[model samples]
Target: GLIGKQPSAEMERKYSNETQVTPQTPPAFIFTCQDDRAVHPDNSIRYYQALMRNGVPSQLHIYPKGGHGYGKRFTFPYTEQLQYLLTDFLNEQLSK
Candidate 1:
């Protein structure tokens, strides 16, 4: 599986995008599922935290359910709510 395939030294460069974030980074919107097994929800948390720490405007939504790969389509109880919230965030951010 992809998780078992740890990057060799040469491929270590292909990794998380966290380090690329900076104070000048643009605003961000992040979300994740608490019950997602394929991906740890904290990835979103960490990035959101980083964005806040770096002074970038951001919004994060961690649903109590909804697993990985929720994407743009409808899924789970809170999917539509999250989408609406995301839309609101986008509108607010883009307006400023």
Candidate 2:
């Protein structure tokens, strides 16, 4: 929406997660849905790739369905699976 309304460098830096990814940045566990239309899944994918290149330990999940707002609300069909992923990732990170 903001991109379509008025594009700017500041907006891009703030809104684009990939822009903030760096080698020294903390690791992340990212998830996205295949059917998310509001924001293309590339955002997450790009960020994951950046993390990998930066040698950060990261996990990514692309659900078969769900959408942009599927997080926390747990309203999607595969929300249970996503929860499992999040739990596993957190456990592993915490143990390390």
Candidate 3:
């Protein structure tokens, strides 16, 4: 619910618009859902794309299911796997 429960259209637009622009230093990894309809998955995808295009060293994990919300309740079967993936990603980044 922490993802898109907020009912402020202005805030939503602001958040979406904010990520469209790439920052000087992007994080090494970004995990998001591809079918996130409420918050617009393109935001993460675009950011990831921008990072890749600029060679910022990052990765994106897009689940085929699950919309907004559903942070870590394991609503989907692969949620635990995602956690492992995140851990591995962080470890890899730290090792670098």
Candidate 1 error regions (>4 Å): 1-14
- lDDT comparing candidate 2 with the true structure: 0.83
- Per-model TM-score on C-alpha atoms: 0.79, 0.83, 0.66
What is the Å distance of residue 69 in model 3 from its true position?
Answer: 1.9
Which runs in model 3 stand beyond 4 Å of their true positions? 1-24
Candidate 1 accuracy as TM-score: 0.79
Q: Residues 1-96, candidate 2, lDDT per residue (tens digit)?
A: 647767687888888878787888887988888888887788889999989988899998888788778766756887777778888988998999
Shift in Å, residue 44, candidate 3 = 1.5
| Span of ten consecutive residues with least summed lDDT in model 1 | 9-18
Cα deviation of 66 in candidate 2 (Å)? 0.9
Poorly placed runs, candidate 2 (over 4 Å)? none
What is the overall TM-score of model 3 with all chains considered together? 0.66
Which of the predicted structures, 1 or 3, would earn the higher lDDT when compared with the native? 1
Top candidate when judged by lDDT against the true structure: 2
